[model samples]
Target: MYFSRLTFNPLVSHQQLAQTLLQDTYREHQALWQLFDTDPNAARDFLYRQVLEQGRIKYYVLSEREPVDRSGMWLVDVPKPYDPKLVEGQRLFFTLRANPVVTVATAEGKKLRHDVVMNAKKQMGFDALPPADRLPLQQIVQDSCVPWLQARAESNGFSLEPEWVTVDGYQQHESFAKQQKRPVRYSTVDFQGILTVTDPVRFRTALFSGIGKAKAFGCGLLLVKRV
Candidate 1:
């Protein structure tokens, strides 16, 4: 895998255009494929995350091969290979922007949905109680997202240090596909912490495959650094 960063230049266009590139699903998907020289149909191997750092629009991407610089709206750095040798018990610090959701059975049948935190609260019977008896949203999210992440790590070749994990920046995004014209809604949560590599092979797969849904729309990219 190769890693790259693209920073949008507001001087080339309005900030709205840059923001649209980050939010509009179809536009961003098409824009990402432009980084490669091959046909759009063949350029399907990549994961990207859009982030705002120090008031700048930046995107971090991981791809199977080096990317070609093809856009004037943004500046792309030379892509670097991310193929790392792995071993058991290696500790690292990581951050992930993921769409955390759960599958639930509804009247229509099984559906994958967001708000794992809300469901946790409901399981505690908070919805049936008075407002004052309910837990704060932050507390509920912290309680719920940790276990959810832990479950993901168990199969993904990592074990998160419970004491070091922190969850914040919870948000929901609504987008539409150009062809479908129907609204698509998803929620995102940011996770940061230290983790031990438990299964090298599975962990490598997790690194390349990403963590959750909406991977195309800037979610589920796990960015990590050796600690």
Candidate 2:
């Protein structure tokens, strides 16, 4: 074996040190097992955990699982006093999903633009929203659309009243108003646009005309460029 058992301070609290080492070793074993036994998302998450405080305690190779051949008994080999510890847990079996990345950030199906309202509210954490996740999509639209519409109208020289008693009452009749490029004051709850999902498998079948509520699609976000 290329690795040796790391020496621990015998003079210090031996029980505490042993427990720490054992726990650390167990986590490594469990994490490795999950990479194979669970979904790919679990495997991905397992690899990026925060660094252990006791990273110095080296791992020694334990006996690998071998086929029982003709002898119908599972045999456990004794490793030369190694640090690789055992962990106990029910092995979770989950069927992995298809491409879930498209839901979060994609140009197709208006996902990126549509998700902007949700994403911003998640960041801001408004008191009315209360912990962010509880906010409904409809409320987000109301808060966002009003401001954007007002800004859009003002830029073209039309004045939009904040608290309007009626829907259609802001038409200027003078040349002064005509002199400026006043946008037509028309409001609708509909903003329709199509975004492209580059993935053929995702675009052709799973993602279609409208929104769908489906979870557990094997997906995660990656940023190649440093923000």
TM-score of candidate 1 versus the correct structure, residues matched by position = 0.89
Local accuracy of candidate 2 as per-residue lDDT tens digits, 1-227:
11122233445475545544344323333333332354433422211111124654332221222111121111222334312221222111111111111135445645442233444465567556656456665665555544543443322222334343122111111111122465322112322111222333332222211112111111111101111
Which runs in model 1 stand beyond 4 Å of their true positions? 15-19, 22-25, 37-43, 107-109, 125-128
C-alpha TM-scores of all predictions: 0.89, 0.20
Instruction: List per-prediction Cα lDDT, in the order shown.
Output: 0.82, 0.29
**Candidate 2, position 104, lDDT:** 53
lDDT of 1: 0.82
Pairs that clash in candidate 1: none
At residue 194, candidate 1 shows an lDDT of 99
Residues 1-227 of candidate 1 have per-residue lDDT tens digits of 89999886556677647565656765776776787754755746889888899987688999987877656766888778898787999999999988878877788786757478767876899879899887888888788888889989979999999899999988877778655667887878899999999999999999999997888778888888899
